[model samples]
Target: MDNPGSQEVDRIERQESRAQDLHLDRVVATQPEIGPTPPDGGYGWLIVVSASIYHITVPSLLTLYGLVILRAIRDEEHEEEESLKIWDMDLALVPIIMLVIRLLLESWCRAVVKIFNMPRFMALAGLCLTVAGVLLSSYSTDTYSNDHIVNVFAGIFAGTGCALTGQQTDVIITHYFREKLTIAQRLVRMAPSIGNFLAPILIGYLCTVYTGDVIVMIYAAILMQNCLFLASYTRPIYIEKVIRTTYNMLRDAADDDDEVIYSNPNQPTPAPTTQNPQQGTSQDDDNDVVVFNSRKNAREILDPAVQYRERSEPVNNQARFSSDFSAMFAETSSNRFSSNFGSLDVINYTSTSRYQELESIDRDSQNPQPLYRETTVNAPQNNIVFATEPTAGTIRRTATLKKNLITIANMLMDINFYLYALLHLSTTFSILVLGVFFPAYVWLQVPSQTIWWVATTIAMGHGAALCFLMMCLVLPQNINEKTRLCAAFCFVGALGFYGITISGNRSFLILWCMCASFSTAASSILQQPLYNSTLNEFDTTATITTTNAIVAAFVLTWALLKNYEYSTCFLTAAILQAITAVIFFALSFRRRR
Candidate 1:
């Protein structure tokens, strides 16, 4: 290395080569002519933390968890006779419809984000909606025959809050810490686990000890209100400091260095004005001023152009080197980088969550293509968590669809995402319609029917769990592995449970659910990883959803339409598994190539 002030500018070439080996080098960054930074830092982490807690506490409470107990509106509730009748098929869809509506509404909210960049306002709107929604739910004991109507209202409030808060938080994190992405995101992802770990037990204890409806309502209200109040702490993300564009000025400065030529056998050469700076550095000539403040943080470091344009300061730098880095906000004003500096280009690296959000200069050098590598960082925690932008060296071929055609096609393409939901509903419906087939069938056989049913069910659940786990691992979006693993383990543990055939005769449905959920964890884990990696390759075409839908449609139709008869359901499931497993295996390998 040369003296800090005299390092060669050409060293950028070497660093360019090095970029290829870094994982970031693999992705192509989509660079708009100018890039925009998200609002980041300050209270962003607080928002993520709050959201995590909220998600953990509220979402966990369903009829199953009994976090909130319903009033005996059942006793006075007109419109229904028996409690069992009240809990019938029509009412069961309340939560499901609410969730669906919420997702749809949230999608609408996401679309409007471009118009509302104000984080504080967004957060406030979300908080208010949440409070209102819950309050409304409290009032609607038997309000509507369609359970979906009430549920949708509640879901919309919560879902929109989550979506809006998430955007604000993400932008802020991007502004604050561009480097500690992976660690920060993992912390955000930890929210659910952290909240759920104790919520269940605490709520359970509260439910057991407090039998009164009023007290139970009070407790639930308190919990919710506390969460709502804490939501304020999430805060809006902001960046006070700004770094303006200076690459052009820096490049010009480097170019002004004295040039020497050895021509016509031998020629006298002018001495060098100064060697140019390298990939992350600066140097200067009489007309140019170099600024090198190595000790300053990235945001605080004065841009090279800023230094060249600033007025000179009276203070002298120490031998060890120090400068008024805080006061060095020169923008484009001429000023020297008074502190120790080295390198050619001022890399201007920005980071988020896990990956560095930037273009790979290495790929640029190799092909020198017209396409620029670009990467965008979404600083949020989701089931999928990879950078959204495509990789470098990739040729983007976005399918140009006729608008009319796409509109027509989209209406028919619901099968992909909708198939799973359909299967779930159909499975339940089949069991109901069959009128409790298993236990009755088993009553005739006695004890032998119980063991065989239990054993087969357990085996199915075990296999299903394995399949889910594998898929999850393969899924590329890098969802929180710990959570996925925990879910997987729970499925596996559930396999130990015994079930009597629905007929009292012993059939394998309970065991079946366990096994399917378990096997699903394998596929589920791999699912995001595979999707993510392939996304880098395929962009956002219908590859994953299409494949899953095609496979699922066959499996679900066969399994459900056949009426879930234990006699042949397992055989259908086994064959479905064998075929899709092969297809998935093949698809999973594509990214590696």
Candidate 2:
């Protein structure tokens, strides 16, 4: 009783719907599963402990060498007319070299990861290099005629090693402690202060007993402790990437079908036809999938209204699709889908269930739920074992490099970043000046017999600063307040340094040390506010690299100067501190405006 044309149309519609459903099922099946959620505590705490130990040991050497080892070297090599200058310059280059190496590694971190796939292996390599550098330096002191050149070689090794170790620690910490990251960072930050407090006293005492070369060997031995701790850096439980490739492919296919059906109203919807596998036309379908998946945010994909609005736009189908496809996937051919029929676009495929759970948790933040849920054998769980399976695919190194360059350029363009960088440079310069010259100043002021007392006083000052930092963590402070406090501390420190220049009285010196140490510690704590106020996009690695480079430049300039006199150095530091205080005060006012 039905017309033959109508019957044909009904059959075509049913066939198309069935085909679409079948395609969606295949796409869904091909999607990569999400990995397990981070266990915020348990094993994660072990990682925190490892990172803390690293901060305490590796970074503490910087202070130890500056305060204790440098002085010992000066005494041992005192016969050389320019030994002091040469040693100071050589040591100053250590940090500069380290910064340069760190910058290079960070810039090409993706490539480095490819080369050293496992974080633990990278860390082990670093440890070996560091120990080798220290041992080499110790050997150079005794063996080499031109020890400075050898020292420089040692610096290169040490710098590269430290950078690698530090990078892996940061990566692992971030990987392990997602939810409890803030807590872990606070705990880790405390380690440096403890190291700063303890290293001076311990090393100073050892200096009384051992020679410089022997002490260097001892330090190398201590660094070996990192090997035992490296075991704590368990492989980061892999999480599935949250990619929307499957969704995008489905959306694009639907859109293409819609376009075909609507191209001419007079014509009936054509029956779905199979294309020849040998023909090159399937590349067009692959291109469509790539173009649609270019969108970054999941929210955009989830919003039905947005999709409807996009479909309504009067875009030239072939031109727009081709342009978008080229723009998105032109960087790498691997991003494109395979030419075979029914084969899903596996590029950028991510775990769905994990993404949903994380999204849901973010939405219900007020009533937080456990990250992991119990699953049954029959229940659907799309967990991917990242260790066994390649999560997503190899990231394009060139693309990442280009992106980082763009980000750095953008940061450089911002006037606020420059201000923050200057502030950071000033604070670091002051800290370095103190670390490098403070012991020498103390030695000149106090009798040789009473040097231990001065060292103890310095240690106590660091302890006081540690307490102040702990207090700052607890006390809720806005950016304005932190800036004001930093300014005040700088002023107080300037006064303390000026006090030291005027008189060498033991009691007064003790008071000055405490005041100066507290102020120095404040610089470390308060720089956070300066950074927050200035940077629109806060990148930890980039910010650190910029600040370190600035500080290194200043330190190099300082080392080049002929003035090694304790009084002159103290006066210069005081003047710089006062200038920094004024700058901070000005910054605070500008922020208010």
Specify the highest-TM-score model's number. Answer: 2
**RMSD to truth, every model:** 21.3, 22.4
Q: How large an RMSD does model 2 have?
A: 22.4
TM-score between candidate 2 and the true structure: 0.60
Query: Quick one: best lDDT, which candidate?
Result: 2
Evaluated against the true structure, the overall lDDT of model 2 is 0.61
Q: Can you tell me which runs of candidate 2 are displaced by over 4 Å?
A: 1-39, 67-117, 140-146, 238-410, 450-454, 477-480, 526-533, 538-544, 561-563, 591-593
- Judged by lDDT against the true structure, how good is candidate 1? 0.38
lDDT of 2 by residue, 1-593 (tens): 98999999999999998898765323323344533455578878988898888777776666655555345544544343232332443444444454445544543453475465587788888888878877766644331233566667777787778778777776777666655665576667567777778878887776777765677788889889888887677564443222355567778777652221112223334445557778533212211211333333211112334346456655424232232333333332222233332333333234333334554454567876544322311223443223232334435666778788888888787666765666666556566656656665665565343435656766776777676667656544344455567788889889878887786676677677666766766676666555665574756567666766766666666755564655776777788788878876777766442
Tens digit of per-residue lDDT, candidate 1, span 289-333:
223333442222333454543424343232213354443333432
Clashing pairs in 2: 35-240
